[model samples]
Target chain A: MLGPILETLIGGLLTGVLYSLVALGFVLIFKASGVFNFAQGVMVLFAALSVARLSEFFPMPIAIALAVVVMIALAYAIEFLVLRRLVNQEGIILFMATLGVTYFLEGFGQTVWGSDIYKIDLGMPKNPIFVLESVFPGGLLIDPSELIAALICAIMVVALAIFFQVTRVGRALRAVADDHQAAQSVGIPLNQIWLMVWAVAGIVALVAGMMWGAKLGVQFSLSLVALKALPVLILGGFTSIPGAIVGGLIIGAGEKLAEVVLGPVLIRMFDLAGGGIENWFAYVLALMFLLVRPQGLFGEKIIERV
Target chain B: MLYREAGQFKTSYSADQAIFSIAQDRWFVMIVLLLGFVGVPLVANQYLYTEVFIPVLILSIAAIGLNILTGYCGQVSLGTGGFMAVGAYAAYNLALRIPDMNFILVFALSGVVAMLVGVLFGLPSLRIKGFYLAVATLAAQFFLEWAFARVKWFTNYAPSGSVAVGKIELFGFAIDTPDRKYLFVLALVVVMALAAKNMVRGRLGRSWMAMRDMDIAAEIIGIRPLNAKLSAFAVSSFYIGVAGALWGFLRLGSWEPLAFDINRSFQVLFMIIIGGLGSILGSFLGAAFIILVPIFLNQLPHLLGIPLSTAAVSHIEFMVFGAMIVFFLIVEPNGFARLWAIAKEKLRLWPFPY
Candidate 1:
């Protein structure tokens, strides 16, 4: 019993880390542009699909490097062609434009890759580090892949924190986030800042995409992971990085725990075939969080002007 | 000269307050309604009624529901599809379980059920507003979709997770034919559209507009936020629910949960945005524009004597549709309703150098 619980916890933590990575991309864009990019999940799908196709011919490492370069170029193109044109639009218009981007990317990705699921060979070293013995007689076992993913996520978070706090460009990015007009008054080129932020967001999306694809195999369904991040954003607040990370863990673990504890009872009560609450648990939890604190765990309270 | 209203005069306040005070406008509307009710049934073919008119009418009704909430109430929603699903499933159950129940009664009762659900989901609006509320409504979308998909009760434990309705009848007259179905939907559309127009022109509508423009100012003027918000939800859901019932029973005749997916929500929302938020006329225009444009695009190649694959047509359809949305937003951010108003203003001063 203890072993299974521990294993579930580990699995939940790894999945939560990936969600946090996606959430980071969302926050980066929202903070800088004040527009929620509904297409962020599609960006992940595009990156994963691009990498999978590229790796069909090139060696693994070379394919990955090429994919990175392509993603960066794609980032620049999106900024130059789309976001730049949408500058000074209302937040809702910008949001809808990203929705258009979502549709365009989905169709374009499917047309290019042909709607078939592709296996992603990231070539990461996959081995169990150790087996854990439960305090109970029958012990649970944990996988090293889950631990590795979590560790990688932690390192990435630290690096991002350090970059934002220490680097000059990061300072400029923060300035732009703080107040776009004030940052402009300080001679920061707003368009350049937007391009930089989008690039950074695209890179984070690539990392998230690769990690998630390595787990689930590259497919359109991977975009549903964005649904998980929606609740995470609501729980952690839209603008808080730390909130996103913590919120992801809470939601991921909460879903798993609900499945373990209440899945059977509810299944019997509802006379359902599937006895797991994993699908609806996260949404229900997030709805409760919204009711309790709409600002979320770490979001700033909004002040409406008359 | 026949279209001109030069001799029309309002002698009383009630006459001036009539829905169509101008003689020309009144006569034009009567003619259109007459053509819809009496003319279309006689001349329209089955394919036109089933494939084009029925679907467009149902969608226009749904668009009107969304326009009430998102346009007049100023609350952006992404759960229109979910609420529609609730109405549909509820109507399905009501029509099926109650052996002697009339189909029209089922439709009306299903709308009431949808209203309850709408108010339940709308409770979040008391605390959240704007984009936050939009995100909150997504929970409703996913939850309802999951419920319909996973819960066998919704499908009445059918072998497949799909529901179907038998032929509908009213007053011992079978409504199985396309002409009869078209007339049925047309009648509902006229009744509901008039009801919506009247509702929006009333005091309740003013409160909603006030809240939409500025909630704080509305509160300062003594309008309770809770009342204004929840009533908007109820009324909006009521219309959407009826539309859903009609969509299921009259139009599709059979459907899976996929009929009311998130994409449906976005489509209805886009209709409201493009059609003009607060106007009933805008809903019809928006729905017609969205529904007809795709059909026209699909048929264009055939009309032009070019053979194109359906896949290619669909792809081009998507691209052109997306581009058109951006173009319309750029050109007239207020939507087609605003354009209609502008035209009306011009008509009020025609043939003169003001």
Candidate 2:
């Protein structure tokens, strides 16, 4: 029992890292533009589909490079067509516009790439390795893909942290996030910053899409992963990147544990057909967190003055 | 000149406060209603009723419900689908268990059940603000969806996790036909819409609008946040719930839990946003546009002599919807209803220039 639990915990933490990858894009956009981008998930699907299809005609590395270009192009298009027109709108309206983007991307991706399940082979090992053999009966088995994902996620987060702290563009991005008007007053080009931020978010979506597409196949449902990341966003504040990481880990671990351990107990207690509690478990947990701390675990404290 | 209301006069408070204040406005609405009730039934065939009128009517009610909350009360709820599901399930249970209950009462009771659940989920609104509250509502959506799917009791232990209702008989009239169903739904919608209009026109609606505009300011003006938010949730849920029941019973006839999923919620949200928030008429316009545009898009390949696959058409439909949403948000965030209002304003000053 302990061995399986330990295995699940470690596995969940790795999956949580992947979730954090997706949530990070949301944080980047929210921080820069104050837009709660519902399109991030669809953007992930779109990016993955682009790479998967482009790879059919080109080399893997070139496909990835082209996909990055595609994402940057998307950022420009969104900035020019949607974001430019929607400046100074209410947050909710901006949020709704992102939903529109989500719809368009879903259709556009499918139409351009076709809706079949496309494979994204990153050449990551699929085999599971066992560890702690002496401590556990069958040993704790772990997937190397997940381990690689975790490593990649760690590197990305570090790179992002450095970008935000040690670079001029990053400082500008932070300034824009802090106060749009003040940032503009200080000679920051709001349009350029928005374009840059959206481009960065698009790249993040590309990385996330590659990871998720390799794991789950590039399909329409890849976009639904956005729904999963939303709970993580709530656990970690919308504007905090590190908070996104921590929140993802907690939610991922809690959901897996509940699905594996408490699932059967509830199944027996309620005479349920089967255990799929993880679907709602993360959301309910986030909701509870909202009640206690609406700003999230690491969010800036909200001070409402009438 | 005909559209001008310059000569209209009101001698009493009732006349002044009439829903359609202008005499021309009153006449237009009366004519439209007459056409809807009498003209439509005679001309509309089965396909028209099933594929168009029924759905537009049902969704309009749901849109109105959502408008009441998001537009009027200023509380954005992504859980409208869940609240609708509650109503659908509640009505199903009531109708199934009690064989002799009136269909009208069953619908009302289901709305009430959805209202209670709405109030429960809405408790978080007081603590959470703006986007935070919006995200929190997803909890209700997912949880309710899970319950309806997982709990065998809700589905009456069917091998398949879907529920079906028998023919609805209201006072010896079997409402199994399409036109009959449309008429029943139209009558209910008219009544409910009037009630909704009155509610918004009264103090409750005023308080809701006040709260929506600025909650803190509304609270400072002595409107309790708890009461205002919860009441908005309750009323909105009740309206959405009835629409859900109508959707399940009248529209789909037999369905699964997937019928009222998050997609339905988003669809209704789009209706209100495109229709114009905070306007009852906008709900209907939004519903009509949402329902009709897709149908029209699907047929464009045939009509325009474009040789496109069904898949391609659907994809284009999605792109169009997305582009339209952004277009509307940019050009006119108030939606089609606002456009109509502007047209009316222009008409009121037609053939004359400053």
Candidate 3:
């Protein structure tokens, strides 16, 4: 009993790392642009697809490098086309524009990289590892790829934290996030900062894509990883990176545990096949949080002005 | 000169307050109605009725529902599909449970059930605003999608989780033929569209607009945010629900939970955005544009003698819509309705060098 429960906990926490990475992209863009970039999910799929396809001819490192260059170009192009043109537009309009971007990317990604599923051949060892065998009769089983992903996420988070703390652009980013017009007054170019943030977000998406693709084959469903991140963003607050990490962990654990514990109970009570209760556990939890605390765990209190 | 509205004056307040105060505008609407009700059905084939008009009309009602909440009330919701699902499943259950129920009555009750669900989900709007509220609506979307998919009772225990509607009849007239279904859907759409028009022009509508413009100011002026927001949600859900029922009954006749997914919600939202958020006619314009554009896109390569796969055409469609949306926002955020209105304004002052 203890072994299975511990394994599930570890499994959930590891899955949460991938979610944190995705949510990090969301927070970065939302902080800089005030636009909830709905296309972030599709961008993940696009990045994964590009890398996977490019790997067919080029080596893995070369494929990843080329994908990075592509992502940077995409970031710049988005800044030039949609973001630059729609300055001072309503947030809702910007959000709608991202939906358009999502559609474009969906088709564009499928068109460029074949629509059929592609295996992201990371070539990671897939054999199960035994831990605490002596302590428990049956040891906890762990997937090597998931453990690697969690480690990469930890290192990335640390690197990002350091970059933000000790860099010039990072200070500029903080200034802009605090107040856009004031940052402009202080000689921080808003457009450049936006471009920088988007580029950083693109990198974040690429990292998230690689890991998720390795776990679930590079396909359209990979885009839906964004759906998992949304509840995280709502719970963690869109501006706080640490909030995202914590939110992801909670949501991941909650959903996984609910699937194990509550799913069967509800299934039996309803006298039906197993309810895919995992699909909505995080969202329902987030909804309850919204009702009680609209600002989220770390979001600043919103002051309405007329 | 063709579109001129000069010398047409309103004689009274009621005349001034009429939907189309301009003689030209009124005449245009009347002619369009005649064309829709009479001209189209006379010449249109089964493909046009079954494939084009029926789905377009049903979806327009759904779009108008979304416009009320998102456009007029300034409350962005991404749960349009979920509310529609509520309507579809409610109608499904109603029709199955009460075999002898009136078709019109079944649709109405479905709308009511959807309205109640909308209000339940809408409780978050009083506390949150903007994107938070948008995300909140998504909870409704996913939960409802899960409910419809997971619960066999919603689909009447169909092993495939797909439900099919029985024959629908109104006053002993079987709604069997494609044209008949088209006419029925059009009539319902027309009534609801008019009703939506009327609702938007009344006190509640004004209150919604006021709240949209500035919620705090609207509240200061004694406009209750809770009342206006919830009503917008309820009414929007009612129309969407009716559309969902119609979609299931008239359009597909059989569909699974996938019919009303997040994609469908986004589609209707895009319709309102591309059409013109605050305009009544914009809903239809948006819906028609969305439904017809892909068909046109599919036919374009064939006409040009270019060999493009269906997937390539769809990709082009996505790129075009993305570019078009950004282009429209940059050119005019008021969308295609305002573009139409602007053309009319230009025509009114044509042959003038300004």
Candidate 4:
């Protein structure tokens, strides 16, 4: 009993860290542009595809570097082509535009990188390591790649925190997130701020893409998985970075643990055909949270100005 | 002079309440319907009826359903595919088990099933709004897709987890051939389109518009947000569900759970985006555009005699389609319906400045 529970918890936490990485990208773009950025998932897939294609002939680091450059160029292109024309449109309209971007990126990514699945050789060891032998007797098994993901996620969070606190551009991003007109009034270039945020979001997406690609192989489904982080965004609060991390961890652990424990028990108990509740468990959790607290765990209270 | 309603006097409410008060507009619809029902069926080959007209008409019905929620009621739902799946599977189950069931009744019941699911998913809307609500609907989308895929009962214990509907019969007539199926779907779509038009033009529609414009303010004006929102969801879902039934039964003939995936939801959404939101005419226009553009793009290379790989052609089509979506949004965010209205407005005063 103890062994199973410990295994589920550790496994959940590691996957949760990756969810946090994806959710962080969502939070960044949502805060900066207030658009919800439906294309974030596609961006991740696009980045992963770029990295996978580049890494075919080049070293991993160089491929990653080129991927980052690709992402930056994408950021600028999006801002110039889509966002510039859509300035001052309704939030939903902008959101729809991002949906358009999603279609464009999906097509672009598949065409450029080829739609066939490619395994990302990140050189990260994926062997299982057993620990807590004294408590569980049989011990709990954990993957090395998951541990690396968790560690890298922690470092990324810290670096982002410092960048927000110590950097001038970060300050400007916050300002723009706060109030677009006010940010522009204070000598911060609005377009440049948007470009910077998108570039950062692109980088975050690249990280998430690499992590998820390494786990699931570089394929079409990667985009869909990134979208699964949406409920995490809503749970953590779209505007709050810390909220995203916490929400990601919570959703990650919640779904994984539930899938491991509750799924089979419920299936057997109720005579269900099979147990696949992981798809909706996190969503239901988020829906429940939204009902009780419409603001989310860390989202600001919505005050409608008449 | 060709399209003017200047001299049309309405001495009674019924005259004023005519669907097309304008003489030319009334004539136009009649001509179109005449062409669809009689002339087209006589001349159109199997390919046009099956490949283009049937699919377009069915999809338009679904687009209209979505327009009610997203365009009219101001609720953005991403679970349209799931709702449609509910309709499809329900119809499938009813048709499979109830050997004596009426085909029309099966379609109606399918709509009801989808409506119930829509309302269930729509429960989140009472608390959440905007993008949050959209994500909640997404939960419904993923969950339903999972349900149909994993649950054996929905698929009637099929080894492959896919269920196909057999030939549908209405009264004494069999709708087996493409032209017959096209006519059947067309009749259903036309009736539903009329129903939708009247619904939007009536009291219930005003309430929906009020709720959409501003829920709190609408509540202040004595409209129950619950009633308004749920009814919109109910009606919208019913249309989509029936459309799904037709799509499965008539168009695809057989479909798996993957048929109504997230991409289907997005496709319908795009139809509304490009066609025109908040307009029934736009729903048809949007569906037509979405269906035709790809077909046209696919045929373009062949027309040019370019020997490109099928995969490469599809990729180029995607690129073009994506670029067009952005271009359309940038050029006219209000969509083709609005553009049509602009053209008509311009035509009323043609050969004159202002």
Model number with the top DockQ: 2
Q: How far out, in Å, is residue B228 in model 3?
A: 1.2
- Screening candidate 4 with a backbone cut-off below 3 angstroms (N, C-alpha, C), the clashing residue pairs are none
Give interface RMSD for all predictions: 2.4, 1.1, 1.6, 1.7
- Residue ranges of candidate 1 with Cα displaced over 4 Å: A125-130, A134-139, B1-9, B300-316, B346-354
Summing lDDT over every window of 10 consecutive residues in candidate 4 chain A, give the lowest-scoring window. Answer: A266-275
Question: Which candidate achieves the best lDDT against the true structure?
Answer: 2
Ranking by TM-score: 2, 4, 3, 1
- Strongest candidate by TM-score: 2
Task: Write one digit per residue (lDDT tens) for candidate 1, span B247-270.
Answer: 999888899889999889988888
- Model 4: how far residue B133 lies from native, Å: 0.4
Instruction: Compute the lDDT of residue B24 as modeled in candidate 2.
Output: 90
- Fnat for every candidate: 0.24, 0.71, 0.71, 0.54
Candidate 1 chain A: minimum summed lDDT over ten consecutive residues — where? Answer: A129-138
- lDDT per residue (tens digit) for residues B136-239 in model 2: 89989988998898888888888899999998999989999999999999999999999999999999999999999888899999999999899999999999
- Per model, how many backbone clashes are there? 1, 0, 0, 0
What's the CA error at residue A185 for candidate 2, in Å? 0.9
Error of 4 at B186 (Å): 1.0
Query: Which of 1 and 2 is ahead in DockQ?
Result: 2
What TM-score quantifies how close candidate 1 is to the native fold?
Answer: 0.94
Q: What is candidate 3's TM-score for chain A?
A: 0.97
| Worst ten in a row by lDDT for model 4 chain B | B345-354
- Ordered list by DockQ, greatest first: 2, 3, 4, 1
The TM-scores of all predictions, comma-separated, are: 0.94, 0.99, 0.97, 0.97
